[model samples]
Target: MTIFRLPTAPRSLQKDQPIKFILDSEAIDCLAHNIALVHPVFDVQAFRQLALTDIAALGFMDRSAHIAAALKATLPAKFADATEVLINTLTPPNAHTERLGLGVFFYLPHTRFVAEYGRDHKHNAGEDPFDAAMRAQYELTRRFTAEFSIRPFLMHDFERTLKQLMQWLDDPDPHVRRLCSEGTRSRLPWGARIPQLIKDPTPTLPILDALKSDPSLYVRRSVANHVGDIAKDHPELAFDLCDRWLSHADKELKWVIRHAVRHPARQGNATAIALRKAAGGR
Candidate 1:
């Protein structure tokens, strides 16, 4: 068993505080080993050859981009074929776990690769590329969270992707339920901004409404973050949601309302103030 140590951040880039674990050489090696286990034909040498140069100089996004490009070089030339091969090679998600780690962490780069490949490729005559990407993300999320990878599909096909997210609100897996809210967040951290969602978050209201009291704290936290993201750009809409959900709020629902209003409350927004007051200023 090989143990991989996370590389230290370079002094010059320490202030930005890059997440060192996700893009380190160890992460690449872990991914290579796992890919080799699942796909005997995987070109481990070729992948490392393309991935390790000047890796220490790159930030998180740059590292992800390099790994993704490396995957394109080493995997099948045909995008669909490569995606299917990866899907088949994926380790199953642990139904009992909550946090992502271990082999799961290694899979994140592959998930990003598949999502990017789907975005860049053309589907067969009757197939929808967005649907294929969504399916790949769904499978990947079982092993590791797909919160970041789902953004591109949401950006390219808002209505269709949103409809699928709405359906995911009731998914059996907490991870999927979390994705429903997290992926749609207007200002998801480390994710590309969705201008349409920032401008008007009305479409996401139904999903939030359904998830505010979700049994999974993991899912509910995402709902709070989703509403909080909306609050940044559309405070009125965020307030409206707080007003509606607060009227008959339970403990869990109250938590969501409080979290959603936190940014606004700090900024002296009237509705946020009222919601805080209604919660006995807790």
Candidate 2:
């Protein structure tokens, strides 16, 4: 039910700062304010104090989890209602596929909140947790990457989640479209692992096929990484897909194939090397 819109200008010039610094006390203050704007009942003082206590020792992800805990403690008890507040807290969605800066990292705790506490089969008493969480990610992905949060849904309900992802292939936002491929990636670093996707990777082939020719390079790059993951597990499947794709690949598709095979090519796999060479070598 969310419509994502990207910003027309760039943001965040401080690329060298530590990633963890993005979620410092300043972040907590701002987050508390944002939630208060949308949720009249949110206790900004309680949320801030709770989120920031003894937080200097925590790392980036730990701080995110800690804030998520604070949000869970302070926000509405019902998952559905809480998700609405969190969604309202999100900034304007990013319209462009690339150039989104560290400003996007502000939502790490938001997505982390969804990933951690919202994993129950039915988070809300009566509402379908999958629907609630997916809707949040569908909008949040535009503001921040939802690839990490979405893995839990894939693990909990592969069929329903994959079906939803399939429907999103034609999404107007490039970020949403890219999520369809990146979220299903079996070997996604820092995300939940799905042994089924690692062992087979066939279920996602339809997803890959749908996105292989996508106009957005951002989407194609994610698809390439997905195939690279598959290549690690099922080189035969990966090789065959690349071989078949090469039969009629355009310049963009060719680049995807090359980048996808680079991992195996580094190890000197003959077919991988051959494929890379045929794709014109990155």
Global CA lDDT computed for model 1? 0.77
**Residue range 1-282, candidate 2, lDDT tens digits:** 433322222265455656677788878887887777778788988998899998998998999999999998899877878999988878777878777777787888989988887767455776567778889989889988999988877887889889999999999898999999999999988787788899789999999999998999999999999999999889999999999999999889999999999989999899999998898884
Give the clashing pairs for model 1: none
Deviation from native of the Cα of residue 107 in model 1, angstroms: 2.8
lDDT by residue for model 1 over 53-104, one digit each (tens)?
Answer: 7778887667877888888888767766667767776655658545333445
TM-score of 2: 0.92
lDDT for 8 in candidate 1 is 33
Q: List the candidate 2 regions with Cα displacement exceeding 4 Å.
A: 1-16, 121-123
- List per-prediction Cα lDDT, in the order shown: 0.77, 0.86
